[model samples]
Target: MRQDRAIRTRNLILESMASLFNEVGYDAATIAALVERTGLTRGALYFHFASKEDMARAVLDEAVTREGLSPQAFKLQEWVDLGLLLAHRLPREPILRAAIRLAVDPKARRLFGTRWPDWVALGRELLTEAKESGELLAHAEPAAVSRAFVGAWTGVQLVTEDLEEKLNLSEEIAGLYELLLPSIATPAVLAKLDLAPYRAERLLRKSCGQETPEHE
Candidate 1:
């Protein structure tokens, strides 16, 4: 029970910190701000994190995980699923949003490097597997494609946040796949792919054991 309470408190602190960081970039977010945001004393916050940079680094550590994603028959499909899921979750998950913001912020990035490389590594791993499985076109290169896709994904996120307040990221990311996949995937593989924006929502419902409509 003590461990459970500690875990809950730690998570609460992280979540509150993430929200604060997202609202005001990393450099602007301070220990005092977090103390006010979490309604926890400075010591309490310090108990979980040594400093503001420490907290930001902790959030970055979670930036590239595949917690909610499941394995797919096609490794390429798995890669798509990961991106779509991130799009769906980013808006709702302050930690992820904050991590992305910090990664792009020059001051924050200089202090503590971003997780962009980790994301690219994961993408390359998945794409390499897909290539080995005969899912990619002859000219497609996993290393180059993975790096380009990560850059495109990051650009889409930044542009959407700046230009459209109400745009859905899942839809935007799905559009990205639709445009890029044709060049990377074989004709047969591309035809079999499901790049629907709502795929993540349906996947969540299925994971929760809730009945998703077949039409979706």
Candidate 2:
């Protein structure tokens, strides 16, 4: 119906704005430029969004919603789902990472600035779930553990991001999977992690030798 078109048009506008946001920082983005990029006149733009700030808010909500999808609506489950989702789609959608950086802008404080707290909450939830399943270190503090894991993963992605093009992602993950796999799990559960993600593992396998301490 008419409402559907409005939502769809809003989404189109948000998507155009996100593309621009990724290229330039959020403060630098402008309504006129957005209009030019989206091929929508000022009137059409206003019809869908009250103002440029409104459009930015809409874009943040859309990005968060997309990243926050956890299959079911449970908040904790959403955190874990976020992990899998990031793992599966990150190579293809580097913009998601860029979007997270933009979340911290003061002017857009409502959107990205509070994500660190969200990350803290996410860390607590995920570790709590893992503990309930009897899968964590016996004395692990959920907050500390969660923060460590999320921080490490986030930092690693930042560090290794450039490696994706120069190196093969799947093969690399497979190799790392073969190593980190054991630390996080028992032999039984660890067996289930796909080693295709760890690049070193594939290379070691090709060499037909046991994994060394470094890559392992």
Candidate 3:
């Protein structure tokens, strides 16, 4: 019971820190602000996180996870869903938004490295599987394609946020896939892909009452 309470308090601290980091970038998410927002004593907050930088690193470390993604017959479709779902959820979830903000901020990134490599690795794994299954073009190299795709995806989100604070994230990502998929995917697989703005929402709805496991 005591351990449970400690875990809960730690989570509350992280949640409060995420909210501040989301609203204002890392530089502005001060330790005092976290204490005020969390209504926790300075000692208590420090007990969980030695400093604001520690909190930021924790958020960045778990920034993007592969939880809640339902498996698909096509690994390429799974990859598409991963991006679409992140777009769908980012605007609504301040924690994830905070992580993205930290990732892109030069100062914060120096303190806590960006999670781009992890994302690239995840993309490479999926693309490799798709290629092995003959879903990709003969010349599609998974490593190079995944790296480029992650770069493009990061650019797309930054642009979308600049334009409208992510009001059009799903639409923007859908357009990205539409333009890029043709070059990588085979004709049959391309035809089967659903690059809709609401694809993630539909997937969630379909996954209702179902057990969709997380990917490591």
The predictions' CA RMSDs to the true structure, in order, are: 3.9, 10.3, 2.5
True-structure lDDT of candidate 3: 0.86
Q: What TM-score quantifies how close candidate 1 is to the native fold?
A: 0.92
lDDT of each: 0.87, 0.56, 0.86
Off by over 4 Å in 1: 205-216
Using TM-score, give the best candidate's number: 1
Model 1, 1-216: lDDT tens digits are 988988899889888888888888787888888787788998887888888888888899888867556777889998998899889989888999988988888998998899989899999999999999999999999999999999999899989988846988999999999999999999998888889998888776666664643222
**Candidate with maximal lDDT:** 1
TM-score of each: 0.92, 0.66, 0.87
The parts of candidate 2 lying over 4 Å away from their true place are 63-81, 90-95, 104-112, 160-164, 167-188, 193-216
Ordered list by TM-score, greatest first: 1, 3, 2
Candidate 3 regions exceeding 4 Å error are 1-8, 164-166, 205-208, 211-216
lDDT of 2 at 3: 93
- Predicted candidate 2, C-alpha RMSD: 10.3
The residue-level lDDT of candidate 2 at 100 comes to 56
Tens digits of per-residue lDDT for model 2, 1-216: 999988888778877777776677688888889889989999998887897677666654534323324233233333444454455455655345445546646656654453556666766876577666655546656787566656655555555655546754444433443444345444553444333343223333433443532221
Q: Whose TM-score is higher: candidate 1's or candidate 2's?
A: 1
